[model samples]
Target chain A: MSDPTVVPWPRPVSAARPESVLTVDDILVRFQTRDASVTAVDRMTFDVRHGEFISVIGPSGCGKSTLFNVIGGLITPTSGLVTVAGEPIRGPHPAIGMVFQEESTFPWRTVLDNVAFPLEVRGVSRRVRLEKARDVVAMVGLTGFEGHYPSELSGGMRQRVSIARTLASEPKILLMDEPFAALDEQTRLLLGDKVLQIQQTLKQTTLLITHSITEAVQLSDRVVVMSYRPGRLKRIVDIDLPHPRTSEIMTSDAFGHYVAEIWGDLRDEASRGMAEAEASRGART
Target chain B: MSISRADHAPALVGAATLLGLFALLELAIRAGLVDRYVVPPPSDVVASFARIVTEEDIPHRFAQTALEGLGAAVLIALVGIPAGLLLYRHMVLRVAVQSWVAALAAAPLVLAYPLFLVIFGRSAMTIVMMGFISGVAPVTLKTLEGLSATRRVLIDVGRSLKLTPAQQFRLVLLPAAVPTIFVGLRLGLVFALINIVGLEFLINFGGLGQLINELAERYDLAGTYAAIAFVVLVSVLFFLALERTERWLRPGR
Candidate 1:
């Protein structure tokens, strides 16, 4: 069942408010195997406004990544539509850029080259692309390391390079799939801050898939919580916090309330997910 | 400084071990603990190196083996890499032929020298062609392995950027696969060199293998060892060149 309640931005009424940049409208995704077909997502509907930062959180088995693939145009939904700037995505669209959780930086290329890869693929001239890449690199706080390779950088820095690469394309919507899941908590928090800063500066419309309630509360304007397998929107929690958010805001009572609210919604789905996982393992054994 | 020392440790130990083995063989032969005829004393082999260089016209023979091995390497690169790419590109082709190609790598290809001789007529062409077929298997198989081994995330990154198939290959897939492809290349070269030398010895035509055959027939055990040593040198040079090329292609690895 699709939740028809599309959350309105709680900002003060202003003429300068931006329009919707991305829409995930009534989406469903099903994967077929040798013996059975699995429904991963069902009637998933959400809209990311022009400059909103949103996080979608769910249990481990929830179809967050499945939904992300549909939005990124890497996979088509079994039914329904994903659009960027009102254009339906047939395949990977230039208006939608994605940063994966896994290490996606090419080890062979220098930071500058890695950042410039999207522009290069788009056939932008070398000088112009490098110029644009430099700007993104600096925005990601990876300056003075342009000549360095991914192998030389720490894991956090490499993720930054991945982000810079996507930003270099200047997509209308940025999709990040648990981009900090691989990092330690400390590094994740710091990188989360960097992402918040970058989003604030560029006003980039972003959707993040995360399992971390603290992360969702720390970075998102609104957090979409999803149910277990055959993932559906469980609730959309409004994170009514001030801008210029950082780890410091994580100490605020409002932040804790948001985290607790989302966690309260997630705990049951997580237990169901764990029980299903245990049952599957029992069957295999 | 410490890292450089650590890096050179294996090579230094290897050189020392080689020299120690030669010394041990020399001592064993002198003390009559081993037969000196079949395995000539290291000193005798060393002394004959000069004579082979001057009398047997070693330089020309060395050059011939090098050229044959080089030709095989070029052929392997040209045919094997594309074959790998084709296999990767088409699932049906890969499923149908990959196992057979893998079997070819393990097959006793050198025993089929008669067929190559019949086809190419006992010339360097025969040797080159035999080496090519023998070596090409590994290159093709490894190329497929390398391409297949590329991380899924990297391919997704390319797709997310809307890269074309060709762009994905060149910019993402190929570069990511280079180290593995080079492993395939190196293994192919070894196979190619072994076949080239063995075929030259069999047909009694050209290269260090021919000199090796002649020296053995003449019962010039020391000179035979000297020529075999030159064959080893040729193999070393080919590998060294391949290493240089790999480093050039994917630097700072």
Candidate 2:
């Protein structure tokens, strides 16, 4: 099969440094309900090195989002510490930026304005921000369409705009919550290539929350698998794929091996997740 | 971006249907198929427009009604929009006052013109106040609804950016609520105009409504119909201006 996800442009070579940029130490998140207190994340400990791409894969109810939120400082952990470059995160940290799963591009803003939003909020000068916005917009291959509104862009393009917006602030880490979960398989693969290229270009440290086996193996330096809720660390599988990765590598034997290994780790947890989901739904009715 | 012929179809059809109805009324009256006293010939009504302008001083009356309607609209936007924001800001205030605002929208507030006249004392203030009360509800309710209806994800996006509370409201919340707020504004204007004209007719104070009452009392059917036409004209003009403003604010919509 031909690979459309591979862009024609040359990718700059950059290696991940051994120094840890983000550390989540024994993080726990618990939600209290009228009936019972639910533990969402339990003792999830991990460290992301500078310029590493990490994908956390799990079953649907595996609390990947809970962990993602905790790391982003959106949810205060019931206990444990989250630190960025040794500094603790009490709230939304300046060192981290996030992309949401849902459609998040401001409808009122054009492509340039949407990308410039973070800078604008930081009180960056209009001329400087727009110039920086133009550069990021070009980086995302959305040049010549800066004036187009979110409503005018395709789903993939809007997600690209979201990515550009986050990158504008030059955060130390990027946290994405299934940013391509809403797109189809083909678009997902294409966007994965785009994201891979951008990450390589900027040498950005990224943590992706996703359920896709192919995506986990295709983009990650390491895949962290989680068990179903009460989510916990299952295993961390290092992807042995080559650098400057593309969807073309998806057919390789190493990539297939990683997919199967991660799938093995997830299958039992996925079944458990489904059973609990059914039980809770039945109780609701 | 290009306007096609099909895009204009509904408007063209509407204009044609109205002209056809007017022509039918004109023919029926002239052919003696209908009572000329009750339903004046369309031709006579059209001719009476010039007479009313010359004799009845229609310009001043039109201006009075326009001014009252403008006053009500200004109050609706200024007081009504801020009231909505305040209500949205305070959950306690919103829960306490939301249902009453909804009830106010449904109430026949024009009937309370006498109460307004007593308070503001038999002047333009009375008419404007009546209109303002009648019109304010939709603006308040719609504003509340619009703010409440903003997607949670958008707010999360703003929060993730670490935006201050004021910046979040001004940047994310207000702009997202705008299209729906404009819906309320348009509806509120319609209600305000109706109450303004209705009160004018009731109090025999000024504007097309008072002119309609005077022409009817004089037993001039053509003049009454002519005055009614001007009232319709005012409503149409108001709607057009509002739509223009809305389009300018949200061009993507």
Candidate 3:
């Protein structure tokens, strides 16, 4: 079922542009489980431009997260290629920073320490890392909670710490997988605005995978709608909105138009995904 | 900070219960409800303890046993921890050593005491050897477990940061494995103590266990009971000290 809040847009046929920062050429990922070989991502292809915030919206099993993983070099693709800045991504690159969906902040570490982790791993001096970590934490508006461990922080706060950690690494490319999805609606919206603001200020090239249409519309320059199971990119809707976007923009006419258009593109894919999920559930039962 | 009486209650109750049990046993022996020869009265045990403290040359024996145990523990940790890390770093070595180490760990060190005696003789050497054999397994196992269990994400973080293998081990693997290694060390110490005492008793080596054996042979019930109690107290104290040390050393605990 499609969300009733979607406002449809005039369909555009060609939206592809040049000057790509990240290019995924026919990437395929197969998981070798105990019983079966499950294809998570199937020959998916797309390009993200430099300094562009691209949000990938897909059904539950559409391999958006897997794509992010492959991009981050956490997992290797079974077949095909992924290139960043014209170089094949064989393993995790320092230039690419990842913020996971689940709060990945180290529970034993304080917010500042967690942010400093990437720098610490690089053998950067403690004082410099701490200073940079402080700057990033303040950038995420988590200035006062620098000394608080992840366990002491709320989920939204923890996510902010994760973002700060990623930013501390100073990676040109950022890959985030539903970073704000675990947060409450109000917190999600607030964090979403902060993230957009930071990305705008830094001009970071980001690939965000989220199911929230409003989130994608508010933050991303282009929203890539994906189909489930053997996931493929269906369409890329460009949001020509200016940066430093706020919660108010979420209520704008352009925002509504983008949401409706992306929802329309995702409608059939979402139903197919739901049916596949139900059948799989039945099989398991 | 304000102190609470409730916080101290469990400890007080525990101490009182132990004293009460000792008093009950002493009364039973005094009343002829229990055999006085087999089970010494609390007063007699106390007197034996005082004799060990003031009159008998027990301090020398205590120092000897402590030195042997500490030396064995140090040697075991130094040798075993690195060996375990070597296995963790090399898959082929790990596969080759897995079954052998498992078998060695499972086999009782008591069964090997006679072999140690033949090789090292019925001296402190045999006791130390026994202690080393008993303690080494836990340290190796714990080190291996800790090294292998390091988070893949952390490793990736290290790789992304372009850290050398040595640097990665130093910064990430060492800190991550410390808690697990400490657990192994604690278990190894317990095993070493048990083995040391058992070997000393079996081989007539001079330690508290040897004292217990000597007292038992001459039918010195009070002395034997006193020695046994001393051994229990030492073991408890050793473990408590170790627990405190571990708590202090553990980062962010």
Off by over 4 Å in 3: A1-19, A31-38, A252-254, B1-17, B23-34, B86-100
| iRMSD per prediction, in order | 0.9, 1.2, 3.0
Minimal lDDT window, size 10, model 1 chain A? A2-11
TM-score of each: 0.95, 0.94, 0.85
TM-score of chain B of 3: 0.87
- Cα lDDT tens digits for candidate 2, A87-116: 999989989999989989998899999999
CAPRI class assigned to model 2:
medium
Calculate DockQ per candidate and list them.
Answer: 0.75, 0.62, 0.30
Q: Going through the candidates in order, what is chain B's TM-score?
A: 0.96, 0.93, 0.87
Q: Write the per-residue lDDT of candidate 1 for residues A1-285, one digit (tens) a residue.
A: 632222333557788756888888999999999999999998988889888899999999799998888898889899999877788889888888999989999999999999999888878999999999999999999899999999899999999999999999998888999999999999999999999988877888899999999999999998999999989988888789987678999899988888888889999999999999999999999
lDDT of 2 by residue, B135-226 (tens): 89999998888889999989988988899989998999988888999999989998998999988889999898899999999999999999
What is the TM-score (0 to 1) of candidate 2?
0.94
lDDT for B126 in candidate 2 is 91
**How much RMSD separates candidate 1 from the native structure?**
4.4
**Candidate maximizing TM-score:** 1
RMSD vs true structure, all candidates: 4.4, 3.7, 5.6
lDDT of 2: 0.90
